[model samples]
Target chain A: MIRFENVGMRYGAGPEVLRDISFELKPGSFHFLTGASGAGKSSLLRLMYLAHRPSRGLITILDEDIATIPRNRLPELRRKIGVVFQDFRLMSHLTCFENVALPLKINGAGSGVIKKYVSELLNWVGLADQANARPATLSGGQKQRAAIARAVISRPKLLVADEPTGNVDDALAVRLLFLFEELNRQGTTVLIATHNESLIRRFRHPVLHLEDGQLVPSPLRPIVPLRDRAPPPPDSRRFSDPIYPDAPGEGGRHG
Target chain B: MAKRRGDIPLGNDPASRLLPWIIGFMAFIAALALSGALVLAAFSDRWSAGLTGTLTIQIPPPAAYDDEAGFEALQKEALAAVRRTPGVASATLLPLDEMRALLKPWLGAGADPRDLPLPRLIAVTLEAGEDVDLADLGRRLEALAPGITIDDHGLWRERLTDFMAALQLAALAVVAVVALAAVVMVIFATRGGLLAHRESIELLHLIGAHDRYIAAQFQGQTLFAAIKGGIAGTGMAAGTVVLLGHGAAATGAVLPGALVLEPMAWLWVMTVPMALIVIAVLTARRTVVNALVRMV
Candidate 1:
């Protein structure tokens, strides 16, 4: 659950990049954030992920105000939110397994839990065989899958991703959104920022479109409410290529 | 804190690579300085205690030159008068052969001591913790022999102790400066590490990692480096101290006290490395934590 009211943000003496932004993302909702090249999508995601404070106005996540939250409690608040970056941002020296296991490790999950969940999630993301390989060795699609796995490893309450599927092919991108959608069905709120109009039309979830440092109404097809929308029709590619695995701790759903 | 391998990639960085060597050098100097202070303190206390309750009396050879019996009579009379003093436990005229040995180091061992116009000396021992009336004893010895003088030894002992204390203070000051240098070096290394791993640090921080977790990883590396350097430095210092002790023992009779460190003093010297390790770890932790707190 995130609420931002009349928020304006800028970076150190720079012009305002996000102005008068206000939105409420209900629990278990999924939304795609759409914008042009200089439209401040990443900056808005940065504010959502607690990387920067709003220069003015109020932004609250998980019932705590970002501007007034004590620094010591920021980590706890951050732990409840998962973020997937456009660049993947995996540690180059770490193997894929270690990269995906980072969130769990940061959450202080027991070693047994980390091994079980990380191994299972890697297998589900079609990266089980490459688990021991470094990020440099992985293909772009493999890196994107690894990043998504890491973000969802801790089963964060809210998942905010900036261009989560930019590196993958169209088919694979559709499959990855389904992965996030599955997590959303399991009660995780997901907001994805992207410029892929086809994927936006195909997925048909709500859209929070940004333009010229401000939120604008999307002039497109009507978006479906998250809970009322039926799941994507399942196919062998979804079940066979990447095992239809539930998020790390979400049990019995795939079965 | 279980080790996080290559999380920050600090091991291969220039700052991290150089940190251990700098710490090792600082630890070496600190250990040596501390050992010097410890040995000096031990010797000063021993020499002070040795001179505390004892003194000497010197009587120049009788001027007659041929009056051997008169000189012996005057020596006996002076010894008798000193023995009668209340605080003087006993006084005996120093034998000439023993006096020759004291001068053997300065004069050639082959030279005969009898040729020199050596004064006849009397060794005085006093009651433990008792004060002797040196003025009264000097008057008595002077009446017995005009040239006789009482050597209370207090002034000479005080000077020796004062000199040793000053040297000890200087040694400790060197150790303090070395420790301060070590702290400053650690601070710089930590800062460099933070800068070098800024992206990784931010990634870690953003991925639900606490400031303490990031600091633990940095400090854990520092702890290992510091411990390794500390042991190397302290080990070298101990070996040097032992070799010097052996060298001093070869001519130990020349100096009144040999630089032999007691077990406790050696234990104190060993603590230099431990102290250095503590300082490095704390500095790295504080620096990393403070820097992280400034971030969002």
Candidate 2:
């Protein structure tokens, strides 16, 4: 869980980027962060990811005041949070397998566990066949999928994605969000920063919209929510209590 | 204590693999300069002490009319005066034949000694715990015999001392220059490695890897290479000194060359490797830390 109260950030004498930002993310909660370009979406994600320090105000992650954490203890805190960058910052020299297993390795996971977990995650993301290939050899969408696999491999407590679907076709994007939703259903908190309104409308999860360096409450929609019409579960375990059940099941098919 | 996941595989990078060779090369140079100075100092000390502890009194050849009487008269006075001096442990006027024999090496064995107008010579030796004061001794010898002049080897010893000091300075300068070069090279190599792996470095930093973790890797690698090189170089230098000692013993005469081989002093060769390892570790730590501070 992340809680920020009156948190503000700036970049070296530049204008205040995220001002008086405060929010709470409950366990297993899912939310969409929406904003136009330069709306500090990435900056806010950075703060949540523990990459940048807040210039002022209190920020807590998992009930610990992050600003007061000793530098040596930061890695342990970071291991619990996974991030997928917009650029898919994979090391070109490393194979897809190595890239995805990086987080586990940094956490000193055993070799056997890493091999099994990475294989399972890569297979889940539909890149098991390209596991031996390097990032340069993968297509944009393939790289995005690999990045998502990497982000979710460790089953991090908080998953922050910046434009996770920007490079993929619409169908793949929806499936990726479903994957994040599935993880969230299993108790991982998910926060996605994207500008795609149609996707937000399709998924009725709470939206945290940003404009002019400040948070704006998202207006609630009165339309019939998609979760109300679902068929009865064949078995109780067969269906998850969906966080974004109204999110579209299919929109644009890639193939 | 957090570990870093280095993306760049520790493979056979030519530069990294060549590290031992580079260190060995540096240690070789260090040994060459240090041992050379040691040899020079030993030789200079030996030759100067030998030459300074003795003096020769030369009486100019007697005029043709004065004959052997003039030689005998001056020789007795020189011997009598030398014997009375406090620091003159023993003084004996060299026989004409003995003086002639000294010139045989330069003039060749077949040369006739009688033909040369050799000066009358007195060879003086000094006692332990006493040094001949040349200034005072010269006045006494001159009063004893008007034509006698003394040589206490001061001019030669002074020149040798000055030359030895210069050689020691030169040796020290070489050591300083080599150490400086090593530090600079380490900085250059570290900077290049950092740039080459900038992505990994940034990722590590973002993930909260401390500066010490990054620096330790570089320092450990450098230290291993330096120690390996130092051992190899010092071994080679020791072997060379041993070989020289053998040659010197077989010759059974002090060689004219002034480089003295002190075989037992090779024990001090351990310092070369120790110094090299320390320098490398320190330089690497500083370079890595400085680079990381600039990154975040």
Candidate 3:
């Protein structure tokens, strides 16, 4: 679970890229982050993934304050969250199999476990034949699939994808989205940042829309003021009930 | 099979090859300096022990009595006086031929030593563990023959010891300078390697790899290179030392027999390469960890 209240972030004295942003992600839920170019979608994702510190306000991930966590302890938190970058930042020297196996290795997984899961996930993403190929040798769509497999291989508690389908065709993009949905059904929280509204329409997940360093209210899911929402239940199954009830709207409006 | 964890390909960078050669050259200099110090120390100890409690008595040819019999009588009296000393173990007169051989360096190959007014020399040995009053003995010898003088070889021994000490100190300084240079070179190489592999490092970091994990890759590469270079350098130094010892022995050089290192000294020299490897590994690890601290 992640909660951000009045979080404002800027890069090295530049004007604030994400300002007065507030959102919450319940466990086992999926949401789409929508914005135009330079709408601070990536910046928001970076903060959520513990890559950057916000200049102002509080961020609590998994019920722990981000500002107070020691730098040494941040790696442990990072290992629990898997991030798929828009550029698909796979190590070029590593082959496809090695790239996807990285997260498992970092977690100190056994060789047998790594081979079994990495191989299975690569096959699922239709990259089994390309497993031995380097990133340079793979096509863009293949590279994206490999990156997705790497992100989900560890089965992290929270999964973040930045423009996961940016480099892939519509069919491939739909298939990748289904992969994310399958992961979510198994209890992993997913927040995907993209500008593709047609995909959002095809999948009726709640949307967090950003415009000019602030969150713009989406017609389908109404924004509730931080003070207006009731306290979450003390039980572990707080996400058993939907946070935002289903709202009817056309999904391709943002696109 | 899945690739082994933490087995990243870090040492393959072409620029990383520079560290080993630098370490090897440094190891060579360090081994040479260490060997020189050890040899000098051994020689000094031997000379000091040999010269202790010993004396040399030289009686110049008596000017008043030029005949051979007159010189013989004076020499006989001097030998008798030395034998009477309580701590004197044995005293023997140098044959005329032997005296001429000692003068060969200054008197030239064909010069007759008998024509020159060379002093009659008596070699004196002392009783083991006995202390002789050298000044008292010198006065007694001078009384026996007015021109007779005692040389204990103390002055030359002390001077040799001091000279050897200074040489050893200089060699130690060379070793220290070489070690400092090696550390600096390793630091620079580690930073350059980090820069070249910046993307890899960043990816590793983002995926939750500890700083130590990243540093180990660089440290392992440097350590291997250092060991390889150190062996080459130390091997050359050992070969040079052995060859020089043989050359000196064949030429009948004045150097002491201790110039050829004992087994223990060779063992000490063997540690030079190992020491260099440790330094390289530590320097690379520190440089990399510091650089990583500056990142996310």
Candidate 4:
């Protein structure tokens, strides 16, 4: 679904942050992106999401050359891809439900359909009870889950997540991975960027490693394990109280 | 969608909300200047039309002769010449006392009427839509008496016309300058608003919102403010004009029913708000689009 050949990107006239990058992902395939801090992983994802133009080479998404596509058509192309940001960039003023429903609304979906689907997705992510709560009232883990739900709400054909499990616990991280795995099985290509070595070892997907400004393909690839996996407890189990706190009204500041 | 998320979190910045008021004030000044020019033009047109095809035939003093007999013969000859003219509607000879009263204000109250050798005045009214043949009339008058001067009043009327045209041009120039300044100010204010909301705007951009959508939000908010400002400013200007007209009316001599503001002038003042709203909307839209295009 996505192909990048000899792509290079730089901010202003400075040296390139992502250089000589080349990659191809078939439809419904899954991959992992790994690197240390300042390894140009975010810059690569920014390019993939159509936020930045490649300074040097060809970048194609869904069989069309992105560099040649007119700017007025960029929004339609962006609607086909989903991104989970590392910072959980949810509008603080919006309720959890509104945050998740953004992608559907932007696509001009019918209101009734959006409401039903967004609520179900929130329920799947274990935040149905906190749907009306603001992002600031929710804990870090709750915010992360909300962001993930928002990214996948439109069932985007391509999903890119940067540190999707950063704020969650180990079990919750595994649960989130299972969600990604389920999405892939349902034919959504996934590219996840993370620093969790243990999590990487547990998954059997091919890894795209980045060092400095170059892409280094892994020589030893793990075969896919032949069994369905489920995320574990105590998040998997019923908690004593609600996962997120109640939101304060009237004095809340919206940005 | 999704219950609108509480009014879009717009007009959050104080400056953004206040921008419309500034535009409105500028629009008000524009309305006042334009209306003033229109009134001046109308007043000048009326004065010129009243004085244009007519003349005051002043009978000069007859040398080495009796003053009364000379004046009577001049009056009879001037009346007969005016009646024979094609465009003359009516010719009336003023009495001596009346002519003295006409010059009383300028020449002073204590001046001796008998000592002053004032010219005999003949008030000639012309047909409203007809032009007088001034050369033919002048020849006829010279044949009757060489001392009579036919004043068609063109010189004074031309001076008044030039003065009115200049006033109109100056007023129009003031309106143009105010409009230009308003657009520039709006651009600056919109840029400041964008900078203040930079974080929110970036997040919206990352979420696949196009530049046009973001621009619409800013333009819509600014336009609303401009309309409110326009109405307030224009209303104030109209009130001031009416108050000035009333004050001028109270003084019965300088502007004796001649300083009236026309209805069309008031109608133009009413359009000030709409012009301001359009300017605010367009300027905000352009500024936001330019700023957003620099992002990617």
Q: lDDT per model, in order?
A: 0.85, 0.75, 0.82, 0.79
Q: Model 1, residue B243: displacement in angstroms?
A: 2.4
Candidate whose lDDT is highest: 1
DockQ of each model against the real complex?
A: 0.69, 0.27, 0.38, 0.36
Evaluating just chain A, the predictions reach TM-scores of 0.88, 0.86, 0.85, 0.86
In terms of TM-score, which candidate is stronger, 1 or 4?
A: 1
- For DockQ, the strongest prediction is 1
Q: Which runs of model 2 end up more than 4 angstroms from their true locations? A: A110-113, A169-175, A182-187, A196-204, A219-255, B1-32, B49-67, B73-119, B124-155, B192-197, B220-274, B291-295
lDDT tens string, model 4, B116-233? 7777778899998888887888888888788888888889998999999999999989988988888998888888888877877776666667888789878877767787778888
Judged by lDDT relative to the true structure, which candidate is superior, 1 or 2? 1
Mind giving the per-residue lDDT tens digits that candidate 2 earns over A141-255? 9999998887877666689999999989877777787777767766778999987666676666888888878999865442437674233222212122111223333211000
Clashing pairs in 2: none
Error of 4 at B203 (Å): 3.5
Better of 3 and 4 by TM-score: 4
Better candidate by DockQ, 2 or 4: 4
Q: Over the stretch B1-296, how does candidate 1's per-residue lDDT look in tens digits?
A: 13337567778678888887888899889998998999899888888888887888898987776788888888888888989999988888888889888887888978877777789888989998788889888888887878788777889898998999999999999999999999999999999999989989999889889999999998989998898889988888888888888888777545644567889988898899899999999999999999998887
Off by over 4 Å in 4: A129-133, A217-228, A231-255, B1-10, B102-111, B251-253, B257-259
Question: Which digits, one per residue and each the tens of the lDDT, describe model 3 over residues B155-254?
Answer: 9998999999999999999999999999999988888889888878877777778888789888878877887889999998999899989988888978
Candidate 1 chain B weakest ten by summed lDDT: B1-10
iRMS (Å) per candidate? 0.8, 2.5, 1.8, 2.2
